[model samples]
Target: MNNAWTDFLARQGTLPARTAEGATVAVPLTQLGLIRSRGEDSAPFLHNLLSNDINKLAADAAELNSFNTPKGRMLASLLIWREADGHLLALSADILPALLKKLSMYVLRSKVKLSDASAELALAGVAGPRTAELLAAAGLPVPAAPRRHAPAGEGRVIRLGDETFIVALPPDALPAAFEALAAAGAQPAGTDAWMLATIRAGLPLVTAATQEAFVAQMLNYELIGGVSFQKGCYPGQEIVARTQYLGKVKKRMFRVHIDAAEAPAPGADLYAPAFEEQSVGQLVNVAAAPQGGFEALAVLRTSSREAGKVHVGAPDGPALRFLDLPYALP
Candidate 1:
């Protein structure tokens, strides 16, 4: 078995368990996460910095956005919400610290308070055909809109019909929820399994390596609804909007198959013959592919991407076979 598969099986039963080829991982997040937001400054503060329109987020709703630099490179990808007390921001576990630090620096005078909520929440990914049934069994109401979250604070809830959600539960309440779900036939999964679902979903995660590297659009943020062009200005909003409206994108994220024994680490360099020693792109994330070899997501320069032969390193590096993503590029 490949490392990805092995890792998946090993993490099975934990929140976000690893699963078989294309299987989804469901994790319990109660004690594993935390949730925090600004009471008054939550919405406005987030609106000013995020690539999406915060004002548009309805109560009991969720919005996808990116925290990008002035150059349009994304610092973090976020799932923001309008909770009872304030707004919530959900990001990959790895980028939370950096995100909090950056947001804090920007809050200089703003009334927003940022906290790592991963500790208090139960974050899980539910992939596979049975996700909806499992969620419904758990009492999580199905979301009417795809990629949306609804109000499920006090009781069990479901959303998007099939997609599992990350829930913030008091530490004491998690065991009971997990037990209930387990009794309902929901299996426990690990982080890697969740990662597979994320890849299948075509969701791009921000890691330390790819931080401040590509603009939100370069990663297909708009196609995934991570960018809101009509929203007011935020950091790098101009560049993101212009690129989309003018079709001036020079680089883009892609899914590829690697017939190698090694899994490429995030932020690894990618090269092409046309670029010689100069790098044409960087690896965003990688996992052992179920079909064979390795599969990964990468952001490549437009010119180099057109060449088709993308290498994981210098010219002598292993070859990468391009794979079709679940979504279309703009």
Candidate 2:
């Protein structure tokens, strides 16, 4: 969303070509949408709608949450954290406008102001073993560990997980900020580099085509700290509760590798011949793997997954080789 940084990346020819191992890489996270919520009742307003417990959010910690439809289908996945004014919610830009409009409808009498800050703010995705050291040198209060954040003047530094960190600051400060980081031995990359790291991190955000197509569990939200079973009622609480209480999650998202000529789109149908023409799953997130072929996260039927035979487009399309997810499943 930072036009200037986008121009910088274009003119600099830093479009991420490969996520080389152990290299410090930085990219403008233009694919994400930033929503700023400020008001006396901002917390309560969002607590009543999101899948996680907003009341328990801490000033220095981030929470992964989802905006679900009443029927328990996920519409958007959010990485929420506190800011000086209120809260900052980062999500996929493709679904932001529609999701923001739908969320505003419930504001009826709340003293909440939800503004799209994507255009006003700049996001930088930095990943590498030296991320913390480089960021601290850039005057950012580099977070101590994953899921933690620290304030830095008008900007904020968050360590998403492991070596991956995101910095949110005013658009005008992006060029200087990234210049400092890159000078500190960081490689400037494209958005694709960041997207690949996110996939390996086992995080999924609802895109337009996949909206309302999968529940929180199907995305492995519970296992990844995106849901709170003890939290009070929110939209789709009952259905989410029922799914949790049920015997087991029959469908789930998994990390897989497909050696195809081209990567498939999100929400594309997946098939297992055992199902015989019945779609067994849908692709959730996809990116071209740096190591050739494409790596993706897809929701698959437990039975199909157990059968160990799933393909894309059709039963005979590209065969997907199962891969390990960063986190363990229940």
Candidate 3:
């Protein structure tokens, strides 16, 4: 843990608490980790390995991407951005070591070097109607739109969506940044609040348990700008393209609400009456809803989502009610 960042959080008192009306919040994103890919071959090497067209990535933009097995199953989901020297990939910390090793193996003779950047940087999420104002007061340059990024003091601010921005900076610079944000009326929040907002926005995260469980399309990765059908071959390009053109996609991710006491884990099986003993879906990610209960994103068969009654764990488990995603399914 970063002592500076941790101390700043401690000084802020207990978080994940609701703030008064009109107040904003900054949540620490401890679960996320960063991977830096540098050297001359960074762009093309990554372009040939990941699902998105890294060759087209601009220094001021960020994009969602995925790494898949040859069998076309998604192994990891990534948020990629470019910097002056190299590229940065943000993903779940639990899978970072393995992913780094896996990516290194493909380097061969390429001029690419990959390493974990978690220790060098810290990430925090700020949201609420006043986020832009707070960031401006902190001397940070806020991105003008979603997926766009602007330079901050030796770091960057990425606008994830409406009223939501991610602040990435050196660990040593975090305390001052947090202080500035807090002074500007931003409340401190726990990571769960940020995650809850992510689910509501219909973003998908691939956790350890869910690795290789679905293809990019099954998680609606392409629908949300995570895939590029026009890009040249990657590991699973052939299968991904075939699925898209052949119209064989049977499962899709959906946003839903579950009135349960405990939050369901990612990769938990979801059953429907029509599927009998078989699971018709799997939980992708979930978080406690501000309105009570849980809000989650699950990948389920289209048939099950349309007609069958869905349950959390088993056939008789707590029921899941469908919720509209921020974007329409293709």
Candidate 4:
């Protein structure tokens, strides 16, 4: 366990496990890890590799991006931010080592230096309707919109969505910062609660199980600003662009609720009667809903989603009902 996290939980007591409308939860994001790319060539090096236009990333901004295979399958989805001296990419910790190695392979003559910065930096999720107010009361500058960040004491505060923000700071500063946040009305909740919020927000994270499963569009990456259509070629640029311009995207990620006893794991296949024995969709992420059962994001063939009922595990398994996503699908 992280010492700062342990200390925070010890001081704040156990927070309410359920997600409520006006409550603010302090979530320990231990499952996610960070990678730092530093040097004069950092921007161009990443620009040549990721789906988004990294070259245009502003100093105070962050963006959703992806690393894809040459065939246009997504290998990893990332939340990239700019720092004073480097760039930070946050993704599933389970894939961090392999992703770090994969990214290093393309360095060639670039001056960029990649390192796992997870140990050096401590991250926490602060979310709810009171998120901005609580952070502002703690003397942190609150970002006004998604993808924007502001300095907060010795760390930084990044807005992930309307009422969601991430706090990134040095390990030494975590305890005091968290203490202030708790005192300012942020409840201490487990990471599962945070993941639930992420799913409800329609954010899809790439995990080890789902690596190289779909192209950017199939996951609605472009709809959510994860892809830059105007940017120059990267590894899977041709395929991504072709899908955007010439080919029609048949599969897309959707928000849905499953009335199952257990939350389905990422990459679990979803079945529809129309598809018979073949899988028509795959789970991207799932979290126990505060209301009941489970909520998840899945990428499914458009025809299947429209023509037949979806189920978890098999055709006769627990049924899944589609929920409206925060944004519209193109």
**Alpha carbon lDDT of each predicted model:** 0.68, 0.86, 0.88, 0.87
* Per-model TM-score versus the true fold: 0.85, 0.96, 0.95, 0.95
Question: Which portions of model 1 miss their true places by more than 4 Å?
Answer: 1-18, 22-24, 28-35, 153-164
Error of 3 at 104 (Å): 0.5
Scored by lDDT, model 4 comes in at: 0.87
When 3 and 4 are scored with TM-score, the better candidate is 3
lDDT of 4 by residue, 97-204 (tens): 999999999988999899999877889898888898888887777998899999877678999999889999877787777778889998877776787788778889
lDDT of 1 by residue, 119-235 (tens): 454444455667666666876656665656655555223242235465444444545555556667766664555555566567777877788998887788888778877778899
Model 2, span 28-133: residue lDDT tens = 8878989889988889999989999888898899989999888999989999998766788999899899988988898899998999999778899998788888
lDDT score for residue 2 of model 2: 65
List the candidates ranked by lDDT, beginning with the highest: 3, 4, 2, 1
Most accurate candidate by lDDT: 3
lDDT of 2 at 230: 90
Ranking by TM-score: 2, 3, 4, 1
- Please give the lDDT score for candidate 3: 0.88
